[model samples]
Target: MRTKLATAVGAAALIVVGIGGAQQASAAPKAAPQAGLSGSKTWGNTVGWATCSGTGTFRVKAICKWEGDKHTSWVTLRGGSAKLVPPACRFKIERIGVHQSV
Candidate 1:
């Protein structure tokens, strides 16, 4: 009887620990950086390319929107220019936005 009680208590404790771990993971922020979009432009046809520029001391976040899809990511700028490569070919770039966090 005592052994069964101990086993049940241990199992309950493990369940609580597992739930805590899951909650922590869900609370963690996404890998994407938080920033603001300043300006951006796209070029090319077959293999499209893009450049995003912004004013911020930290890294910049670029959100690219295509036909019916959207991609959010971070880019490091050199000389105020950050290059972006689309995920697919012939995907019309509808909009590109930049973000910077303070």
Candidate 2:
């Protein structure tokens, strides 16, 4: 008799735990979208082949290097697309990064 009572209580406890787990899983929040750095490359005398995507404001930054000179280049992006144009001197991209803005 005692063994049957213990088994019934254990089964009831398992049902209650399973219901709580199901409710918590259904109520969980989804993740929000975020921006990211896509890629960078040289094209002719410009650095226009850079790409970025996803949500929020972002900036694509690059160092344009030519001979003995290098300068900072960047482009502001919103949600979808943007472009980066360095100084119009025969140059190549030496380094790159992404920055989130307000």
Candidate 3:
């Protein structure tokens, strides 16, 4: 009777609320970007060595290519130089990218 009908209505309301909560979570904005390197490069030769130097509140990433292999290394620069020696297969620096923090 009335009690059963009320219980059913309460359950349906809870279900709707739950669905609304899930939708809000799914619609949430993406994460903000942090200080890091952004960009790319294409070296024509084996990039066995690479370095990054700068003066700022940013991060540097050196992308290197060795023979037919490629790798990436990262470094945070406050006001100096940062060097990156990729894995054993990397031979030269093909590209360098920087990202500054807000």
Candidate 4:
């Protein structure tokens, strides 16, 4: 009886240790993707473009619209500019917005 009880207790203790190790492993910080320039704009005579330019830690969003088609783009930047241009369509700058990323 004593040996059986000890065996059960040992198994339970091992399970607790395993759970703790798993929690610690999951809690470890994960590497984030490098923040950089992404996506591009289409160019044309009728295709209008809107640029959101700024410096410092922030996000910039630009919305452009044509007769019925619309395009939107955004970027998170430490310091740079992001442009949104409609593809093969006459678009006007609907709006440009900026907000702090942090």
Better structure of 2 and 4 per TM-score:
2
TM-score of each: 0.34, 0.33, 0.32, 0.32
Residues 1-102 of candidate 3 have per-residue lDDT tens digits of: 999999999999999999998898566333112333222332344444344455434433445554543434334565556554444435665654443444
lDDT of 4 at 99: 34
Q: What local distance difference test score does each model get?
A: 0.48, 0.51, 0.49, 0.48
lDDT of 4 by residue, 9-90 (tens): 9999999998998898566333112243333333444444444444433333334455544434334555566554534444
The clash count of every prediction, one per candidate, is 7, 0, 5, 0
* Cα lDDT tens digits for candidate 1, 32-86: 2235334444534434445545533333222334544334464555446566654
Taking all chains together, the TM-score of candidate 3 against the true structure is 0.32
lDDT of 4 at 66: 53
Q: What is the lDDT of candidate 4?
A: 0.48
Sorted by TM-score (best first), the order is 1, 2, 3, 4
RMSD of each: 10.0, 18.0, 13.6, 16.4
Over 37-76, each residue of candidate 2 has an lDDT whose tens digit, in order, gives 3544444443433455544454444455654333234344
Off by over 4 Å in 1: 33-102
CA lDDT for candidate 3:
0.49
By lDDT, the best candidate is: 2
